[model samples]
Target: MNRWFMTLLASLGLLLIVSGCSTKKDEAPKDPKAAAYDFSNEKSFVVYGEGIAPVHTVSPAQAIVLAKRAAITDGYRQLGEKLYGVKINSSETVKDAMIRDSRITAQVNALIKDAAITDATFKDGLYSIRMEITMSARRWHELFSY
Candidate 1:
């Protein structure tokens, strides 16, 4: 009888272990941005941007509002970076040269204004925004045609 009881207990333990191992609850949370858009195609590029706001000495609502604004601005900046590549300059370059002389930056900023803000989140006193801009082949040509 004791042998049968031990066998039953061992079987139950094995069953529990197998069940736990097969469960999917341990999987990492999927990115919210990826869920909204398909990223596998080569035609579109996906980028993420984040902004942080402090909760100290501020109301919760105020913190959230500030963080969200910061996050949206950050998203626009990120989109601009993608549309217009960053310029690397030597130390000898003038401090205001790029801002004063470059029209590319202004053009990119104009494009970024039209980008879609796909996702925004406020968590742990930090706000994150994700912007998606589609650049199709025709659009690419049109941009360069200007």
Candidate 2:
């Protein structure tokens, strides 16, 4: 009995030591290509847009087609908005200082090139599209006016 107890205690001690040493060391994350890029300005980003199916479509296929077209246009608009910005115009006509009428309008105008539709889906009368665009340093500078 004495010898068995000593062997069991030894086995438990070895297990504890192995488990304690297996803990991860405190170290910074390892980046394989940390110093590869000196000046990287090329990037790609994605945008998403959704459109509701029109009520007056001639057929189900036509509904999906129209919704997909609208979704694609919306995606381009969103991408333009992200790259540039939305222009807003607001007016308030206060007749006799009584706040009679107010109106607000927003618009975005941009020419997007080479934007690819990455994914598109139509479900439950709603169509959505994911568009991606890649901009190199030259394109970036041109758009940013730098």
Candidate 3:
């Protein structure tokens, strides 16, 4: 019927217009607040330090201090620390420990803008350096929501 053909033609024309309009792509807003770092292959570190310092802002200086502090906390307290078999008063080389600590910290800084660290002093003969990925609370929470 003529009416049926007209109806079909009109529907096809409408669909074509709608499809053409959708071809225009939307762009993302530009803002540093929207800036982000991908941490899929991000390095991580586990350290043994005294305590975490509350820094107002994060920087390389803060990272270094935090790394060193984490490398030598809790001389002999937790059962985990005692299990390492490292003698607390023994003559192990502090220089060696510092070197290992630095290596681990470097890896951590490579991951997050604001590093998260925990202190663990184990009793192992050689000073232990553990690495873990850190995320700031703001960044961490923001990542998921976005």
Task: Kindly give the number of clashing pairs for every candidate.
Answer: 0, 0, 17
The weakest ten consecutive residues by lDDT in model 1 span 101-110
Off by over 4 Å in 3: 27-67, 71-146
Which residues of candidate 1, in runs, are more than 4 Å off? 1-42, 56-58, 90-110
Ranking by lDDT: 2, 1, 3
TM-score of 1: 0.51
Give the per-residue lDDT digits (tens) of candidate 2, residues 27-107: 533664442332256768799989889999789989898898899989999998998789999999988869889999999
Give the candidate number with the greatest TM-score.
2
lDDT of 3 by residue, 1-146 (tens): 99999999999999999998987455443665554443333333343434344345387567545644555333222222322233333232357446323212111111123333343333422233343344454545464454
Deviation from truth (RMSD, Å), model 1: 15.9
lDDT of each: 0.67, 0.85, 0.43
Runs in model 2 deviating more than 4 A are 1-41
Q: In terms of lDDT, which candidate is strongest?
A: 2
Residue pairs clashing, model 2: none
How far is 95's C-alpha from truth in model 1 (Å)? 20
Give candidate 1's whole-model lDDT. Answer: 0.67
- Span of 10 residues, lowest total lDDT, candidate 3: 102-111
